[model samples]
Target: MTKDRSVYIRHIYDCIGWIKEYVQEGKEAFLQDRKTQDAVIRNLEVIGQAVKDLGTDSLTASHPETPWPQIAATRNFLAHQYLGVDLTLIWNIVEQHLPKIEQQIIAISNDEGIDLNAPNTPELP
Candidate 1:
């Protein structure tokens, strides 16, 4: 059986949202704020874990080119040694990679005929 695509979509949304808030003051602020780094990194971890939990079929059928494994591996790397996490790399991942992920997820949801604006944006745990 396959997991709901919305769950993973929500994860992507969440990660993106957190990054948005973190970067409100711009890249300079994000680079200087330890708290934002912690929050963003954890959300990135969730995005990866959620992607891993998604069914292989859904991913292969729709978002086939996503680097799901690499995303998950990044989560593991962050979790084990967060003290050494790279700000530039995290910024790159959040600013560059996540929007693409979010776009792909939205495309998949639209293809499935799911209403993205439905009143059920689950809060990140």
Candidate 2:
């Protein structure tokens, strides 16, 4: 069964938070640290997948300005083009786009009355 849309939003929000934390040292550090690059890329992948799982209808209607398709495309490129992935593009995305994306996600969560910061634990069977 599909999970709630809020769950995906939370995942995206959390991933962005993690990415920000990982790159706190800035561009030069990020470029030099392979571990940080992997971590950020992994979070980016998660963000893209979460966006894909969240689907397009509500996202487009609620936030038409958000680049949902491009987000998903980035995930696809990261997942498939591992060898050819460009650090510069990833850095640019983090530096240039993530802040806006983060704000948009916070707005979406607020509009839906979902607390993105809340604990998201699964129920036991």
What does the lDDT come to for candidate 1?
0.76
**Candidate whose TM-score is highest:** 2
lDDT for each residue of candidate 1 in 1-125, tens digit (9 for 90 to 100): 55567767666666677677878787888888888888888888887777778754557666778776777677788888766888899889877998888887788778877666664445555
TM-scores for all predictions: 0.81, 0.94
How much is the lDDT of residue 102 in candidate 2? 97
Q: What is the C-alpha lDDT of each candidate?
A: 0.76, 0.90
Model 1 alpha-carbon drift over 4 Å, by segment: 1-3, 119-125
- Candidate 1 lDDT at 113 equals 77
Write the residue-wise lDDT of candidate 2 on 1-125 in tens digits: 77888888899999999999999999999999999999999999999888888886668877999888889778889999898789999999999999999999999999999998798775456
Using lDDT as the measure, the top candidate is 2
Using alpha carbons, what is the TM-score of model 1?
0.81
Give the range where candidate 1 is weakest over 10 consecutive residues by summed lDDT: 116-125
